[model samples]
Target chain A: MAGVKALVALSFSGAIGLTFLMLGCALEDYGVYWPLFVLLFHAISPLPHFIAKRVTYDSDAASSACRELAYFFTTGIVVSAFGFPVILARVAVIKWGACGLVLAGNAVIFLTIQGFFLVFGRGDDFSWEQW
Target chain B: MAGFLDNFRWPECECIDWSERRNAVASVVAGILFFTGWWIMIDAAVVYPKPEQLNHTFHTCGVFSTLAFFMINAVSNAQVRGDSYETGCLGRTGARVWLFIGFMLMFGSLIASMWILFGAYVTQNTDVYPGLAVFFQNALIFFSTLIYKFGRTEELWT
Candidate 1:
């Protein structure tokens, strides 16, 4: 029941995030789709962790190089996602208001991703590892 | 050799212990620096789209620096020290050579960025923003690579 509730909450938050993203891109005031490129960042942000989890064995060590490298790449992806909208606005490819909306979406989306990982990654019956 | 090197060494700060979070923190810091460097360069590129405004050649420094970052980190510290990675063709010597080449690439890019900054922009009395961007990109990546290499506790696992 708790897992199901978490899933519902996560999905709701994700929907809100995507709504912001779509509004930023599709709104009449900000009629540019460049902010949609951030969707690519959102897609790949958690990939490094997934890869690392598969490649490295569970160990008692403080940290493995594999995990650290994954973390590094994940951080890079997340920062790039945030930087994308700002650069777009700076270059006049998008408006500042659109950038703000996209950034808010980015934060919410990334948090949703984090929440998904936390809620589903714990190796329970609903664990993402099973996928 | 130790005595001579000690002469140049700064007083050690033992306050920072090797906590478990050190690896994650350092890696995240390095990643931020690396991406920030790239994003700054991209900003410069977008702002000054003409090659005459900012030469396309200036980006090579950043590319090489990025290559160096990967090269330097590809070899584990244990591998360089003749430990866990003994099965390679050249073993520890190979790791050391790889590291040396990586360092060379990193420093070479850094110096090249400085040259581009001063020789092309500063000396010519042209706009310095683009050149400064190029320099900062390489510098940030270089520092990021250095921090990634030395900022963590590798021995904690070994």
Candidate 2:
């Protein structure tokens, strides 16, 4: 029962975050959807972690270079996601209000994705998805 | 504030491996370094030049040196581990030689940037940011590359 509630809440929060992103683009005065480019960032954010998980299983080794490289790339991707909206606003391609909205959405969406990974990647019997 | 911070204790984090954190940080630093170099050069391209400003040659050459640094560091440390090998021409010793040439280029670029920085600003008495960009770009890329190369060594040891 609790798991079902958590799933619903997560999905609802995700929807709200996406709504904010769409609102930033579709609002009448700030109708320029160039800020939507951050969606590509959102799509790519989990990719490094996914690739790194495949590169190495949790062995006894203290360090894995491939996993470290993926983590490094993921950090850069996260930085770029935050930087993109600010850059767009700085260059006057997007309004300050829209930039703020998009950044807020990015944070929320990223957090949700992290939560998804945490819940799913937790190595236990109650897997988040059916195998 | 202490109590508030304590409320967010992350004890579970101790279970995770953090040995590679330095390498990861160095890699990100390299990424930032590369980004900054590209940005500075782009800034030079976009910004208007002053009367006595140094032209595009500084940027054009600086990027090549940075490229050399990148290639040098991209090589596996294991490939250049030892100075002796009974094998073919391009064995460990050959890798070392290649590493040597890469370092020379990297340092040469740094020295050249320093010269350009001094020449453009100190000698000519110019104040424009574009004129100064190439020097800073080269310096940043050099430092970042050093951090990356050394970080790779740490990975190899571990």
Q: Which candidate is the best by TM-score?
A: 1
| Model 2 residue B94 CA deviation in Å | 2.0
Which residue ranges in model 2 land beyond 4 Å of their true spot?
A1-13, A122-126, B1-20, B36-62, B83-88, B114-127, B132-136, B152-158
| RMSD, every candidate, angstroms | 5.0, 7.4
Report the Cα lDDT for residue A76, model 1.
94
Question: Considering summed lDDT, which 10 consecutive residues are worst modelled in model 1 chain B?
Answer: B1-10
What does the lDDT read for residue B134 in candidate 2? 76
* Model 2 Cα lDDT, one tens digit per residue, B30-113: 767755665666556555444346575667657777677757876667677753345576787677888888888888888887
Evaluate model 2 with DockQ and give the value.
0.17
| Model 1 collision count | 0
Candidate 2: tens digits of C-alpha lDDT, residues A13-87? 788889889988899989988878888888997898778777777655555667656765675576677777776
Between which residue pairs do clashes occur in model 2? none
Q: Give the range where candidate 2 chain B is weakest over 10 consecutive residues by summed lDDT.
A: B45-54
Worst 10 residues of 1 chain A by lDDT: A122-131
Residue A68 alpha-carbon offset, candidate 1, angstroms: 1.4
* C-alpha TM-score for every candidate: 0.87, 0.70
